[model samples]
Target: MKRLLSALLATAVLAGASLTARAETVDITMAAGHPPVFRWVKHANQTFIPAVNKALEGSGITVNWSEQYGGSIAKVGGVLEAVEEGLAEVGLVSSLFEAAKLAPQNVTYFTPFVSSNATAISELMDRLHEENAELRKSWEENNLEYLGAAIGIDDYLLMTTFPVNSLDDLKGKKIGAPGPAVNWLKGTGAIGVSGNLTTYYNEISTGVYDGVIVFATAAVPGKLYEVAPYVTKVGFGAQYAGGIAANKEWFDAQPEALQNALRRGGVAQREAYHKDLDQAITASLEAIRANGGTVTEVSPEFRMKWAAGMENVAKAWAAQLDGEGKPGSSVLSAYMDAMRKDGATPVRDWDKE
Candidate 1:
């Protein structure tokens, strides 16, 4: 029995030694074009990374995270290609920036004035992708595996150097909007110059553009009110234009445990993002006010007029998608129906006509 006890002690020592040694670690590189200032990247920093790390503890699995952000790996519009090309193993691909490639995934952006609750809009997107075959197909075709909703920003507002009391106030003004958002200005008579958050201040300050179609969450962080102090809350609807994605080939090769960890981390990131964003909206607006910026809301009458005046871009966009051999109308219908089911009353029924 003494010999048997000695052998058992030896085995125990070997197991302890194995435990003391560092576990095999998987290295994942997460990239985003935008800096951490934007909630898109901020959640990645605050939630995604830490959640995965904590979840994998003591599981014989560890991840070495290389965070490339603020244009470190790719520019704002280039994140999709970077992930596709394997430069980034995982990333937040900007659907808004890659609007042309992800056109069918942009149902909300097309149907503006839908709902102002950003979190609700994001949750609906999560449900659609899970329920719709074509939606999943669209992301698969891009060679990225969708992790979870990486919703960002908040309800869009009009920030201009001049106050806007009426639709006529926007006439002939060169306003900056990003990607597909340029269509939001149609029939409003605003010259929708393609622009993004990074340059809103400089562009508006230097007279390159009179104003920007921006979200309060970002406009305040960007200190846009300093340049364009007139903020008109038009409720152009909240948007979900990007999501956490993994390089398909790489993700498929990962162990199922790692894949699940990444997906769970993404979900945690989304929840933390909305919580952070909701709080930031009020705090940021207060800051904007303290900085001498004026905040005004467009009357319900004005909202109706704006919605009516704008051409039926949703249907037009759906037609364009159909021409491209996609189920744009179906996606539009699904999106609007989901919103209505959630008790949201949109000013215009984008899918009706």
Candidate 2:
């Protein structure tokens, strides 16, 4: 009877321990304004989520992800607010739309014709955020925490109904550009209309504009080539558009292991996203050619001339942010310095000018 009682008690203790070691299941709602068709959103769903899951194996923590995308929960300009309000725990917060709050992240947009290597640009921005507290401040101040993966756009190009062999071709033409990209047309003799990817196709087809400043990755998917058969590789440069981020309060409350796992996922996502992007850009350009679309690469002289003709929007942007006590000037200098250090020869040194 004594031995039986001891065995029974030991069994009960083991059962309690097993229950205590049971995995904790966390439900995390990940969101994005764009659909999974977009590379960034696709990688978030495919790469990031799986990386997190793999990292958490046998760690006594698991996540049940609730994915809301394609404006189901938040529109293009609303992801940041959604995460801030706790409507979603994590989101692909597009810095392009949140330029007012995330001014420094949009530094690449102001300094175009720099580098078209999306991977290098995205990794550089991630390194900057890791090393520079000033860049991270914008994310924190907005009640969010930026994860490592930077959603980068491929090189911006010119798509139009007519061929653009020279700057003279764009003279007096209506060109649609998104957000700060509109400034890219300054002194080019083209009228820049503020536009976006979602409406570019219909707007161009309906004669809302004759041309648009867009990227190849998006141009193929959006099928803008059908209407704008002439594609020009202007090399406006890859842009750091946004990143995967979590609500600050929620992220802060997570266990260190779980937090680290999410970060690992972000890093993995960045690699996968860029790999797919490189392939996509190639495939997109091929598709454009096969579909009767004309692709043109301007001469180096033409490119340089185009770059010189643009107004110094970077200086203006940096000055405005500096006036607001943000590290605008520093960010511009740091970004340009880093790009130069990485062997990128900008047609115009934005910070120096």
Candidate 3:
């Protein structure tokens, strides 16, 4: 009886040791600049993280997710810095807002009149990331690893109190724009107010600005329609990619299989994001109209006029980059070539072509 009890006790100890060995955990934190309700953050938390964990299931690895939305960790302008500093292991970065740091990659957003279709833009972005080694290196230099790109809502439109049927209608108006959009205000005679969708409502309400340059998906959730009530779709163009980025330091420390799982999860999340954006835009437009907002389709002639007026911004952007010794000219050229290849007839030379 003593011998049998000793054997059973030894077996129990071995079992406990094995269980402890298999219980390794990896905690990764992700952040987004928008509030929790914004589609980007909502989708990342609800759809992306879960898919990532599931992809790693049964691999003896577990992920602890920490999400910081509403600028809790990084505001829109500060995401890249936040990720690089290890404030969050992973984050949703806005290339548009980081043009100075991500000059070449972010230029895609400045190339107006490209296809407004999300799928095409998403595919183009994926191709760009694959084709441009330098572009990928840009992210790497910042101590971040690119996962996959997610498309923003369709082209920007003017949500204002006044109806803008033509370029002439915008003169002397106070237009709230984010980051690079300030340049968009140059030739139009409209006063440019730097603001984002998060503060758009308050800015408009407090008379800080008259209206905003924003997309529809955000309009509904932000309730901008309740205040401004006029959505003039300028068909400005589709916004190129923004996406999941992991701190390279943290990402490289993960096991190879786990890293692959995270990458696959990012691809899946991007696909889901595109799908959600389509539905969200439809719902947002409906919500806008329901709130007594006017949705008007700008005539092609008018759109052309608006596009023509903003022709100089590209050159200005390229020159600024050239001054910094970055590959501003080469990047801009590549993007324009790609745009034309994608059936876009840009109104002006984005890179003097």
Instruction: In model 1, state the lDDT of residue 202.
Output: 93
List the pairs of residues colliding in candidate 1. none
State the C-alpha lDDT per candidate. 0.87, 0.92, 0.79
Q: What is the lDDT of residue 88 in candidate 2?
A: 96
lDDT per residue, candidate 2, 190-282, as tens digits? 999987787899999999999999999999888989999999998889999989999999999888878999999999999999999988998
Candidate 3 runs further than 4 Å off: 1-23, 345-349
Candidate 2 has an lDDT of: 0.92
Candidate 1 residue-wise lDDT, 1-353, digit = tens: 99999999999999988764644678789999989998879889889999888878767788889999999999898998899889989999888888778887788888888888988888788778878888877778888888885585589999999999999999999999988889889889889999899889899999999999999888877999999999999889888788889989888987777888898898898888898888888888888899999999999998888888888888999999989998889899998999999989988998997
Ten residues in sequence with the least summed lDDT for candidate 1: 18-27
In order, what is each prediction's RMSD in angstroms? Answer: 4.9, 4.2, 4.6
Give the per-residue lDDT of model 3 (tens digit) for 230-277.
Answer: 898877666764778899998998888678887887787778888888
Using TM-score as the measure, what is the rank order of every candidate, best first? Answer: 2, 1, 3
Clash number by candidate, in order: 0, 0, 0
Please give the TM-score that candidate 1 achieves against the real structure: 0.92
C-alpha TM-score for every candidate: 0.92, 0.93, 0.89
Rank candidates by lDDT, best first: 2, 1, 3
lDDT measured at residue 209 in model 3 versus the true structure, 0 to 100:
82
On a 0 to 100 scale, what is the lDDT of residue 215 in model 3?
A: 86
